[model samples]
Target: MKKIFYVFSVFVLFSLVSCVTADNNSKKSADNSSKNAAIENILNRKSVRQYSDKKVEQEKIDTILKCAMAAPSGMNKQPWEILVVTDKEKLEKIAEIAPNASYSKNSQLAIIVCGDKNISERFWEQDCCAVTENILLAVEALELGAVWCMAYPSDERVAGIRSLFNLPENVIPLNIIPIGYPLTQEQPKQKYNADKVHVNNW
Candidate 1:
């Protein structure tokens, strides 16, 4: 009787341990799957400038912003704001200020991604940059095209965007992204460079 009870107790402990291990493995698998999906999206992203005349739906715009917001931020402050421009008049004015932004005229939508200066200036730029890249990748995942035009790094450009949108003093424009259905496909450039890699020490 003692031998049987001891064996039964050991079996129960083994089963509990096995259950915990299985749960952990399941969680790890899910995490890996999610990571793979994001990698696939990134690999397929391409920068697109020319766009068709069709307008993007509000739902799609919201989806793109949702993805952008998912980007990692400094201390999770998330000090970013987006100005979605669909009005032709406003877009035209923006294009005027951004002379090199002729693509804005053809784009069905334009998003002015801004970062709050109150947030650490050091991370603000990098945080906004991550958001912009996420936005581009999201657009590509949704079968749309977008071009990222720098606006904040330049004082004149930032001032123009702020005035155009009547933004608050705290808000600093970082990038101008024109989004729409692409008229032409952009080929991805080969960016691999083995010489740039230095393992352990440079």
Candidate 2:
């Protein structure tokens, strides 16, 4: 019965190979699904100024802040301080002080991203920008709306925020982001520029 034994061995080997192939294919599909979800989240991000009155959950706010901290910092300086404002009076005052960010008056939450010169003297602005971007992306992932208002580089906005918050000498406000549920639906735009891309060499 040598032939019978040989046939059984071949059959078992073929079955094992098929099972392995199936498992690998399943894992690959899962990986692709995760990648696609992340890409979609990036593409679907849109600036939303108007917001619903519904308050944002504290858990989502914490998650977004965690993502902000996860941003890349030059030389690992990691120099960003965050401020969360939900008080109506403070938001109104901010809106008055920063005219361009009038949306803050109606927002349920406002986040102020700050740079600490004492921590990373040279790269604070760039690092704080990364932190702001992470905050926006995380907000989008949580199905919340947010719009960023420039704070730094503008003497009026910067000084206004500094005086309002009583920030120390080394602290600088970078941007103000108002986050909440969307009042008006907006779609993401395709901003890819072929002329702006250089491969290997400019």
Candidate 3:
């Protein structure tokens, strides 16, 4: 009887340990799946210029904006504002202002990432760039298409955007991104360049 009781107790303990291990392994698998999805989003990201006619929903746009605002800023000043345009007429106006972004006319939504010099003068550009990149990645994760069109540093394009939008003197438009369903699928380019890498010394 003593021997049988000892073996039963051991069996119960082993079963409990096995159950705990299985639970931990399941949690780890879930965590790994989430991590892999994020990495895939970054790896497969591609510039998409051509877009289908599907209209983007307000909720998705809001989510993208949330992601953009989540980006880290200098001193956490977060001096960026996004102007989302879904109107056909307004999109056309932006296209005229930025010839390189003529694709905006085809997209259902256009996001203008602007920097407020009043918040952080010197770091505004870098902060805004981080926000723009977040939006791009969020768009990709959502299975949407987007193309970043340069607007700043160009006297002509900057002036045109400012004048058309009637933006304040302190607000400077950095870039325009048009988002929608992709009409063309593109493969991600491998950009791992060991030649440009320098460790400790150039």
Best by TM-score: 3
**Backbone clash total, candidate 1:** 0
Q: What is the clash count for each candidate, in the order shown?
A: 0, 0, 0
What TM-score would you give candidate 3 relative to the actual structure?
0.95
Across residues 8-60, which tens digit of lDDT does each residue of candidate 3 receive? 99999999999999999999999999999999999988899999989988889
Per residue, candidate 1 scores C-alpha lDDT tens digits across 73-159 of: 998988888899999888888788787666888899998889997876668888889999989998988899988988877888888
> Which of the predicted structures, 1 or 3, would earn the higher lDDT when compared with the native?
3
Instruction: Please give the lDDT score for candidate 3.
Output: 0.93
lDDT by residue (tens digit), candidate 2, 1-202: 9999999999999999999999999999999999999999999999999999899999999999999999999999899999999999999999998987889999999999999999999999999999999999999999999998998889989999999999987999998998899999889989989999999999
lDDT of 3 at 93: 88
Q: Quantify all predictions' global Cα lDDT against the true fold.
A: 0.88, 0.94, 0.93
The residue-level lDDT of candidate 2 at 126 comes to: 96
Off by over 4 Å in 1: 1-37
